[model samples]
Target: MLGQTAQLRYDFPFLVRTDSLSFRNVSLADAILFTLTVTLAWFISSSVCQYFRLRHFDGPLLAKISNLWLFSSVNSGRSYLDFWQVTQKYGTIARVGLNDLVTDDPAFVKHMCNVKTEYRRSSWYDGMRFNPTSNNCLSTRDEIAHSALRSKMAAGYVGRDVDNIEPKIDSNIRDFMRLLGSYADKKTPVDLGRKVQYFTLDVISDLAYGAPFGFVETDTDVYEYIQTTEKNLPMVMVVTVFPWLLTLLNSPVLKGLLPSTKDRLGFGRIMSIAKDVAAERFKLDVNDARDMLASFIRHGLTPTEAESEILLQIAAGSDTTASAIRSTMLQMCSNHDILHKLRREIASADIAGDIISDNEARKLPYLQAVIKEGLRIFPPIAGLMSKEVPPHGDTWNGVFIPGGTRVGYSIWAITRREDIWGADALEFRPERWLNNSPEKVKEMESTLDLIFSYGRWLCLGRTIALIELNKILVEVCS
Candidate 1:
């Protein structure tokens, strides 16, 4: 019994060590399991909170917890159609993201964009920066800064301080007409899409720097600029969806991946051109030239600001105006009646030259109506120009929206709303503008004007765009 007791005591340490080993193995497994369980719980809880925050708003099932729906739609290259469909399905106000809502309500868009409104530009504008380090007029969110910038640029864009703006545009139109005559002589198919883009680019450049970029004269996409823009737009649009991604892309570690002025192609080449032009203007006496760049410098714009704003003008002015021209031309061609009617109006009007003047174009009711209808059917910019809710929160359409929520304009949806534009809203009918009663026509015009935006955010290039449209459409139709 003594020996057995002694042996038992000796083995007790071995038994205890074995038990400790087993306990350690179990604890390690338990720790891993506990960590994974907590992580999953956190994700689930976060999703639930997000889902309930905007539960009152209707949207795709996936949008309640993720931005995947929005991302996928944009990635599909049919965001315009997809977004319009969503609004059509879910009413005027619809949830498009976890914290994002889009509305086709013109009143909502007007309220948000009012000069003195509490709403401010969203972070989405951050992704609009051509240079990650700088802010152009369109990308700046600081209200005071934007207002000041707009003041300096307004004179130039309105052509109030620039000379020969119409003559410069006509010069480009002449180049375009010459090109078309050549194509006609050869009986070759003219790619109006490419040619129109060239015309607009050249006109913008000529107005901007007192010399065209020669896009129309050369009859080519110089430096592959248009091709690059088409390629990068989708990705740039996707980046705007995630503000953090934009911040990171602009960060020191990743900014190297962005386009640089040093590059010899695409936007980089355009930046280099703008910089060179600005440098030359800076070398000359400020009073020596009276173009857009000079106008900007006269208004106290810094050299850097001048360059940035000029690039903005080239980019914003050219593409949007080109789009308007293309859509209008397509509509006219599709309906020979509209085309013949427009041509007759231009023919009967007293014009001194081949190129119709802006004043004359304005007098042609059918032409003006056709332009408006084109813009209405397809707004030049279909992106979600979102505005952030005020910190104090506000009610929209009787719904109390929480602060920090983002409300974007579904401009495509708004422009096509049957409630606003009538039963045939989707049709490309110019008569809607003419046949309506005076008050109704006025309302329709006001709604269509929102394409240029409203109040403090009204497009500075609005006048120039109109002048281009008024002149080019008439010339083409004639």
Candidate 2:
């Protein structure tokens, strides 16, 4: 019995010593070193997994391992050119980030954006939200919800449901011309870009509400809208590169830092204006009204939804059309031959008054070609517009893309492809549209139409923008 008790006592002391060794105190440096080692191991493993997943696709070495490459490119303020350069070097399908692939393939873009496409918008679109608490049509990622919202707002955008769209447009054009005339009289160098912006804003505002914002009449950047947008848009675009940042910004804690309707300048002021206009419009009987707000109301949009969409119209509608105008004008000014051709076409066309009718402008073949060519060279919105792959995965040109990958369009590269638009694609040659065969023209037209997007995601503002373009170019040139 004594021998057995001695053995138990010895074993217990040994076990206690082992336990004491296991719980030894770790120094601060040791703890930090251990944490760093674990982090490094996790990072390396993660990079390896990501690299192998898309190792078949070629991109910058850094891009294959991190999103910092993309963030840096976007911050350079010429991301469109950088993206184009990437595709030019790596062919149609090129990796731009750890999990992001961009393609200049029109067929692939169309397939992903088709009416019944399974691809949903990527989380990148979350950065497009104007209101931190709300998702505008541009930021809505769910296909069903986007479609529903589009349906409610389609009538207002289509112009058939709204009254006096052209007259309102003509009125704004008159105001635009008068403003330019004053500039000409003064013999001062006018900033055509700023004036063009004013014209577009006035036109859209007149169409949306019953009256214009008087940007042309006042001859200034109303509410500092231009300055604010210039400063804020780049930062907003930067946020899109990091999905987690968007989540953090939109979260309840940080949401208070974002723009609100009460702010006295920039987007918030515009939002405040929209809210006030919407409030007044909502009090009227729907049957007695004829503007876009009324059309939205008649088509079953609630006051809050209408307010959001009206703000969208003012922001998106004005800027895109302004870009189209400025680019087309710049192209014409740069090429005397093209400018002469356009002027000749406008001068020869039969028009009823100072402003050319949309129908009249459409009949002018050269003018139409000029518009198309301009849009091709400079697509207004150079955004990535990334779409997420379906859960089951997708294959393009026999390359298997893993599920949950983000595929964005290289819009600049696509528009400048030598194969599609011929060797002179980079040049602003309107003759390409006029010289092609009917089938060729049809193909080119279909491809160019992608500037407004395609299928279920086709832009609702397309018709309105076209009307503005069709009138403004002819009137200005004449």
Candidate 3:
């Protein structure tokens, strides 16, 4: 026992010494190093996340606390309800994503849409190439390319040359009216929106491609193309969010995986049909049916260039007008009082027998109001039409938005601003436009409320759309 105690004392001291060494008090440097490691990890993790969040902008919830504030904005529904909610919270210069910036202020809009070279078409526009060759008119985003196409496009869309297409408009309108009897008789809850879509599709298709796909035939065989286009939206949005994946695989299979795949295929097929028509048109004697494609071809477009231009014409010419018509009917349905009043105004007009001949109907206050209101409420294509802010960046409402940031304009946000229009901003009051004093309208013209876009980049289809719209209204009213 004495021997064991002696050994225990020796070992016990050693053991205590070992424990004392291992559990030695932490030095100030040790604590500092530990804290520094943690802080570095946090910063690294946050920076990576911020980069990816901006890169893959499919609406991440983590954006609310991000430094850039883009995550706090744009993280909502694709619908107008969600858009307006965000705008209210974030103000006119709302951040939609880590890189997305939505501005509704007219001054900001003027700068983005009108100021040349400062804001270029976003990468998203490039991502929307339907065919191998890009078209001349709508898809040409740069000022120089746009300018080259616009001169010819303007001739076809506006002036006396376009005015001569009135008969076609009248005939199309008459066909629509003749079909309306069926709606009245059965009192069927006509998907007038869909029907109007068919009518516009057929009209534009016939004029642009030299053949309609029987969308407005007595057989009611329209809407196949529209259905295909509808299926493609999600695919496009998906591809936009993940452009790298698509760029890697340029195969049909890759494109098919896009959220807008259905739309791409659907529209691609229509463009194929358009190409077939162009093949035929290319061989024919050059006549006066300049449906934008012909304009491009006659002016300078070669066979290859013509193919691309024709496809673009077919897609843009039909889809935008169809979008406008659908929105117009929706507005008309929601406000039947406005609908009835517009109809009365139309009925009151003297058409001079030719439905498309007179500007007298266009001079009517209510019809113009309805068209403008519809565009304001539903500006057809939603989502940010991205712009690349110049290297110097952009300024909005006097605030500096950094360059290299992806910029966008929200139709849903802009049209619903209370600051510009007043308390009833959400309400569909045509009187704001139609009943305003003449001098006020002249001021508005100087400021120019451009729902169709502003500056040199405005839609080339405006004149045709307006004329056809007037003819349709006159036919319905008269």
Candidate 4:
């Protein structure tokens, strides 16, 4: 009798068999309503489960449910400051996104960025790639590949090699000074930020490719590369929080959806330039070594490999050094004492040149202190440095972060914390770095150097960047 009833119900469309085994014809609207009710219940249950899964960590309720809050926060143009505020409101170890946690504690920062860390960089870095398919040291998510690449490229960035590249930097510095002097003579208000950016661009380009883009010589961004870089960064941050959006950003088939021509190019001109330089370097005689490109070729890198590394160097080296230079200049201009003292130190060093060498600049303790202070007060890459927790997960600072979770610390937030840096942490005091005992100086150095980064992934271009920054300051102050 039950089989007969089920078969009869199946024969009729939209027929419902009740618990009492009575068959009834159901309207289309009723069926639709019933399906909707079940779907709504499932969705609610799933959301509740997801919320409970991460209930151990504290965060804004909206953030715990959707990445929309994180995306909105980043798009607000003050993501770093906003995330820092999250800590104040929710305490350290706050969940800033559905699957991301941010902590301001230095120990946790150290653990996340350790040289031989179990934690690997998060996919946020994937948004940094010029090409999604090509892997470079900066954008590679694979631990093994990154290490291998870093080892291969290490020779080019060693102190001695960077020193070897200094003459190229010096030549560009001379042109930069000449341009600035022209502005001074004219008494024209110079955009020092743009000038330093052009200077750094020319220097890094020359070192990377045996030629500059002529930004310093031209006294302008000839290719508007700096503009391109600035435009992409906000988008990069957006993708870091909403990685699902990477497809629209990077996919050629979805090119129409991209917001700008710059996005579509994705460093096209720069990559082409790198490739051309690599090709030229590859054809060089074994005895005719030139620059960083030669070093890459010598280390058995293919033309493509050389281009990738050169692109990384130029992109990483230029903007950051420019930021440091601009920040230092602004701080000095605002604080006359710092400017005068730095000038006095440069004069006393007896540096005999229109452009000071890095070694000579290093001798000026006051100048060094000012540079360190600027780096501390205004880190170039002040955003989050995210690392993914290992598959096994780990506990940090008494909080158990689950496996596959993204965690990071903001250099901007960490450096400005009053608890760590004292009540006057907000002050732009270069003197803080000087007149301290050896122990105090060591601790300060440790804190300041963290800006470059920590452990195995420490910036490869740090030496060259320091050279450019120190030399530029000595020249400007003198």
Error of 3 at 54 (Å): 9.8
TM per prediction: 0.91, 0.91, 0.77, 0.88
Ten-residue region with minimum lDDT total, candidate 2? 14-23
lDDT of 4 by residue, 1-478 (tens): 8887777667753565545465577788988998999999987787676566567888887888877778888777787787778887788788877678887777777777877689999977876665444667888888888788877778788743334577787788889889999999999999989988888888888888778889888776666677777877778778777666776656788755443424324366677677777787777773447456666666677777777777777777788898899988899889997788877777778767667877788888888889988898888885566888899889866767778888877777777877666689888988877777788788778877778878877888888888888888887877
Q: What is the lDDT of candidate 1?
A: 0.85
| lDDT value, residue 334 of candidate 4 | 97
Model 1, 118-179: lDDT tens digits are 99998878777776668899999999999999988888888788888888999889999999
lDDT score for residue 462 of model 1? 89
The lDDT values for all models are 0.85, 0.86, 0.62, 0.77
Looking at candidate 1, the ten consecutive residues that score lowest on lDDT are 16-25
Model 2 C-alpha lDDT per residue in residues 341-376, reported as the tens digit of each score: 888888888999878888988999999999999899
Question: After superposition on all CA atoms, what RMSD does each candidate show versus the true structure?
Answer: 6.3, 4.8, 10.3, 4.5
Arrange candidates by TM-score, descending.
Answer: 2, 1, 4, 3
Q: Residue 281: error of model 3 in Å?
A: 2.0
TM-score of the candidate numbered 4? 0.88
